[model samples]
Target: MSSSAILDAHQTAQALPYLALTQEIEALLQDPTVAVPPRIVQALHGGGSLFVMPAADARVAITKLISFIPTNAQRGLPTIQGDIVVFDVQTGQRIGLLDGPTVTARRTAAVSLLAAQHLAPRRDGPMLIVGAGVQGRAHLEAFHEGLGVQEFWIASRSASSADALVAHARSLGLQAQRVDDPNAALADCPWVVSATPAQEVVLSAPPHSDAFVAAVGAFTPRMVEWSAPVCQHLARTGTLVVDTRDADHEAGDLLQAGIDVAALPTLADVVGQTARWQNAHRPQGGPVFFKSCGWGGWDLAAARCMAQGIAVSSAPQG
Candidate 1:
């Protein structure tokens, strides 16, 4: 029997490539036969997040637990870190262990890009990103690789941080600029993405007539990223798409900002192509918004792709 292989964080990181992983995930989502359940996400005290994601399709079952500890910053650790363990459905055997952060960041950004591809206006435009952390950088990379973004405007509370992110983007051959004012950045860019973790609003509604906004922060019931005016504007003019219907209802940003939860379409609806009706019902050429509370199915799909080489075998009988 083949021996089971163990993969450490660094090894897992070396195994997975962000752009290729994201492309594979996008293809899996486009397929109609995949079975991915709604993710279970919990918020712990002191700014932590725990998520359980499971996917099964008769042959195999993959589940991953991802935790985020924002307080780890004080310890000189990552704000987001975790692990992924895969299992074979038939024999209940452990098949693989993967780096959670790599999977999480890549899959999350891929999902956002998928949303953008399906919902955002079909044109090359400037993208304004309002965060300088891991998620923000992931969004920049994914957008550049997956979409036709011509320019990038980075905004953060710290100008230096924004400049650093812009420099990183420029290193990748993207036309990037650091902006002092997020609103000004939004006003100039037709596509805006909010990736911050603020408990309050960080950006006002952009006045652009054809802007598309992708808000991926604020997973917990206590956190929010957009103000009331922004939420209202999205509700009135744009179509709001979420990873799940339940997540849309539970998001504090939408609830606290007074945006009706019923107004958004589920990710399944969009993937299944049922959202065309919702789009047809909405007015033409308005701003479109998409918010995701994160989904596990995406993580499982990506991890399964990354676990291709590791050997899996039955354990010896006790």
Candidate 2:
């Protein structure tokens, strides 16, 4: 695989540092040249889903093919597995391939971090992460490296997984612990990330007034992590933002709560008009909730970031 054009998970991650990826995502969100259509989702027989996501900018085009299998966790296999095929927009040539799961995890977390950068009430705090899966760990790392978070609290359905994530955080020289109940921990942790496969409400407690919550667990209309009360409270007293317009229908937490997502702002909207939005929301001094349901544009940012990284690494040293 060393000489292959397709980079493995580790290699793909190496090419996409959180800072670079975050900047790329922010830039692409505002670029009018980029075109990203809604992803194509096909239902699988075994309660799984196959997603075909495609996006293109002036320079390159990419398509990600991945499967989400909830049952894979039982078999000790990854829930997401596939590859992102990058092509040259000019020549229609296949340029490279990247591990899909890595792109999803890192890009999703990076998007959260980008939102937090603009919306979070405070930069450094005890961040509470719900769920101990891949997205959970990615959020922990993203907040730590991207925001200088020094403390963490993790809660999950599986205590062992939660403990493992806590240990990983500890290894990174951060204060971390596993909490039996996530709702109770929400009071002290001003920053919260819920990343579970939300068959049931995992976080119903209301966030603190100045808190920032990124709900990334539930993507479908049926899947949800936050309770109705939590979603409604955030909508009424705080600010509600979505990663993309597709979240209006696909974000389970918001949709199930009957949130008027069309009235909500998006990450692109905020990033495009940062100063005006900051001025408007700063006076309110309410919590910020960001709902993300995945988007093809994010995958496109990852592909562009990887291509730039490859070019930089292969350049001659002066």
Candidate 3:
């Protein structure tokens, strides 16, 4: 229809342009009353996966379809390629379409940092990041701008990728450097983000007890970014917050660690079922970690925000 809108990658990215947008998304996600339920997630037989997610409330409704192809990176394309379709709640009409990967990259990092706000202590220390890719840069911006990280240390298997990220960070006015020893870097940094797509272990050691680790990659049962020891450490010392309850089944980090995922809590539990999820913690205050395999609710929220931005911008100017 003439009234409908289509948003490209730049416009979609502009929707989540700041930390404040992410803060709103976090609040929405943590609210158990939001009722953004599970969607269809199944692995692809040909080395990828398909995700169909529907997120809605009284005001707006939308669905996102994402396909993950890890090899896309070598093809000079984004690993996540998809689209989000918006629908009018009152009329059930298709209203808008947006670039899915942009919404995802922006929101994923924001969501991870949102968990950090509740699970870890605030500090101005340096932040260490693994995998200097899309998620890595997004996390770096969130930490330096939102979390007040003083410096940044990047580690990656690709020297050029890591160097490029460091330069990008520095250009953003953040103090960034490449590190060879991630273990040592993690020890000094209070905030750590592992954003790689590695199938095997990437972090050899966990940061200190006060450190906040955001395991941002490895969505499949085969791809695990956190090591067994690192996961076990998270299981023993503190509560492991997840993006959704589905992590009980989808998180490779927990499965690799052999941790009983049934005992863990989703970020939604912060609002809905805190008695069991929060009260169980013994207050040892050891290093807390949040593993985000990601979920459709997140995609829905982000896409909705972008759609709203488009609506507001298209309104007749005064």
Q: Tell me the whole-model lDDT of each prediction, alpha carbons only.
A: 0.72, 0.90, 0.78
Q: Which candidate's TM-score is highest?
A: 2
Model 3, residue 38: C-alpha shift (Å): 3.0
Report the Cα lDDT for residue 108, model 3: 88
Superposed model 1: Cα runs more than 4 Å off = 1-45, 275-283, 308-318
> Which residue pairs show collisions in model 3?
209-287
Please give the distance, in angstroms, between residue 138's alpha carbon in candidate 1 and its true position after superposition: 0.8
Of the two candidates 1 and 2, the one with more favorable lDDT, higher being better, is 2
Q: Which stretches of candidate 2 lie over 4 Å from their true place?
A: 1-4, 274-282
TM-score of 3: 0.92
Ranking by lDDT: 2, 3, 1
Q: Report the lDDT tens digits of candidate 3 across residue range 84-199.
A: 88877777878788788877888888888677776676576888899998899888887777777758999998899999999998898888899987877887887889999876
The CA root-mean-square deviation of candidate 1, after full C-alpha superposition on the true structure, stands at 4.6
